[model samples]
Target: MALKKDLKQKMISEIDGNKNYISVEIELQYQPDLIHLLREEINYIGQRFYYKSKDYKLEMCGIGYLLEARYSHLEHDEIYEYWQNIKEQLNTMVFHEDKHHLKFFGGFQFSEHSLTNEWKDFGMSHFVLPKFMITKENGRCYLTYTDHSHKFDIDNIEEILNIVESKAQARTVSEPKMVANKDIQSEEWKALVTKVVALMNESVALQKVVLARRRKIEFQDNVDVEDALQRSLDSNEASYLLLFESGKSQFISQTPEQLCQIENGKLYTNAIAGTIARTEDESENNILKDELLNDSKNQFEHRYVVDSIIHDIQSFTKQLEYDKKPTILTNKHLYHLYTKIQADLLSENVLEIVNQLHPTPALGGFPKVEAIKFIEHEEFGTRGFYGSPLGYIDLENNGEFIVSIRSMLVKGKTATLYSGCGIVKDSNAISEFEETDLKFKPMLKALGVM
Candidate 1:
């Protein structure tokens, strides 16, 4: 109570009429089950964003948007220009030493091309600063409130607290049952993979081109976001648990691939490709891991990823280092060839780094531009955000982004799951199809539809 009074008084004295926004934060001693709060489904808030790190160290849930930037078909430079304006407008009240809750969370579509009507709400690129957010990090919880005004309103602050305090009783909702499932263009996708492989064999420039497919599912009833998210969290703790909800659509995923993590001019990323499915037996899993490491095809696919990432970022990086051989990274249903890469950045321009490094050989293919062109022309439908860089960027330009694989887009009773695999000259269409099947299991299981 005293803290609230002090904050109100402080805002009154320090409010600058010229500024466009104000953000204030207070630490919460009481740790509420954030997932439970989400289960409450506060509809009036309109939109919500959720992110939990792969390591289980950071969890955040945000409600509504105090400010947001949404754009379609904008070039990378233009997107950064809007971000610069956002950075200027963001006014964070220095409440304490821990100033970590202020962040812009969202993502860009995989391509700038025209997408299907299902992706209408997501746009080409969208990011938001939540109106109210709860963050749990290193055993501490903080509630942050941001308003689209220079002057703070005590009534608004009080109301935000009241809304959070009025927690709903936990309910036991059964997972929605699956009614029908459709694999969109299964035979066509396999044929496309074979065609891409033939193109790779003919042209040395395009050694590898990643191919993707979509699966549309129908449920008996409307799926509960909380239920699906909770199941994903329980099952895929080793992967990034992420959700971006806007209006009637929600993009949710538990992805194991980390595209980039920038902090204090240091860049951390992983070259994650070369997939193999996991088995129930530990010895079988080990055998599969060894096979993945030595298999010429998988190794070739993984190398393209490592080489392309280094090629793209070498100019912007110093002392960049990664292993010559990739180790195994295991998730719920699959194992991936993983190579950790780190570098000291010549510049801390996050957007430029994202621009240069995204659509790497892992997702797009080797020889970046050519592979992307092939995907644009050949891919069945547009990839709105699947396989794109999806994560948050903080006010200081230090944040993490994970590749959006093992994901699904949910709208009412229908959900569309997405998965992809790298296609090389030696790749077999049937084998690649199986790999994507493994990838789809994570989201399928999450939705209780597998």
Candidate 2:
């Protein structure tokens, strides 16, 4: 409490005379599990964000909305332009860059146009610069706050400190309960996949389109976001685990696909298609890996992804390179044919490239527009944020986004899990159905349903 008081005094003094810039980071000794704290305590206050990769983690509790830009209807190019405008505004607002601090956190929906009422709150694209944040990186932790206005009140500062102290002291671990699980529209999803594949086989413009399904699970008690996140951390160490809470809806995922990452003037992305189930036996796993690499159907699906991504990014890249042959990337439940692609970025604006590469052949289909239209007409339900890019971008335009696959949206007792598979001419409806089931295993096991 004394340290927090001192920190508050420092901030007050900094902002007392000057109104343009006030940002501070106070080093803390104790490191708390941020997701646990968010779920257990801070969520009641305002919007909360939790992001974790292998080496870095950030948890943000919005003290107040510093700046927010949302659009319900906009073209992709227009959305990118609006975001650039927002970034320009953020650049002028002074914030302390204490190593791993996040200036903003939010995501874009899968589609530019709204599809259903379920994702109305999320809108088509939204990002928020929170007033308070805590970041843990490289075994160190810091508490940070930023305010660019003259209305910096001491009362709000004290409230934030109090909440932090309370959450730090009240840490308790609890187990998540396993409850009933129901697959929504099982037959309809399979039928849709069959229809799309049949069209592809008949020389339709769509060569490969990914189809998704939802599974609804009910828990005996209120679902704990922290508990599910812990399961994700335990099961998938190589994946990016994130949680974003807006009002009653909590979007969370442990995903392995990198939609795009721009850092130090280079662009990085991956082609993660062609999935195969993992086996407990090493020899069996090796055999499955070989089969996936050699299987014509899986290779064809993967080829479309590589080709589409290369074409999409060609305009913005000066020099591009990617692995000629994909390597096997294994998770707890499945393995994927993964190819790494790198390029020299022509512009500092990363969102432009992200807008183009999104819904790649891996997620949408071969011909981007046609595949999306087909999915829109054929799929049973709206894809809220599933298969979309979700991550943060800073004032310097350095950021990373992960494809929101193997994820779920939890509201109270009910949670909806999303999983999808790429469909091509040779794709079997039953096989695609089984592939989706395998894809669901990660989240299902995390939720204690398997």
**Number of backbone-clashing residue pairs for each candidate, in the order shown:** 0, 0
TM-score, cand. 1: 0.94
Clashes of 2: 0
Tell me the tens digit of each residue's lDDT in model 2 across 1-450.
Answer: 544566556555655433353455566676765655565554353376778864444433434456566667534465556556654433132223445354566777887544586666676777766667777766767666666657545565455555666654454455556567889999988888778878887896888888889999998887877778777776745788888776678888888888998988999998989988887899999899999999888888888899999999999897899999988888776888989999999987777777888888888988889889887877877788898888877656788888999899888888899999988888888988988888887787777766
Model 1, 1-450: lDDT tens per residue?
A: 235677678767876656787787877777767777676647633489899999978899988787668887745666667777877876677555787577788878898867679998886878887887888888888878788774467576666566566666757757677888999999999999988888878879888888889999998888777888888877755899899987788999888888899999999998998888888999999899999999999888888889989998999999988998899988777788999999999977777888788988889997888999899988998788899988888878888888998899989999999999989898899988988988898888888765
Q: What is the lDDT of residue 251 in candidate 1?
A: 93
Runs of candidate 2 with Cα error greater than 4 angstroms are 4-10, 16-21, 42-46, 54-65, 74-100, 154-179
The lDDT per prediction is 0.83, 0.75
TM-score of each: 0.94, 0.89
RMSD of 2: 3.1
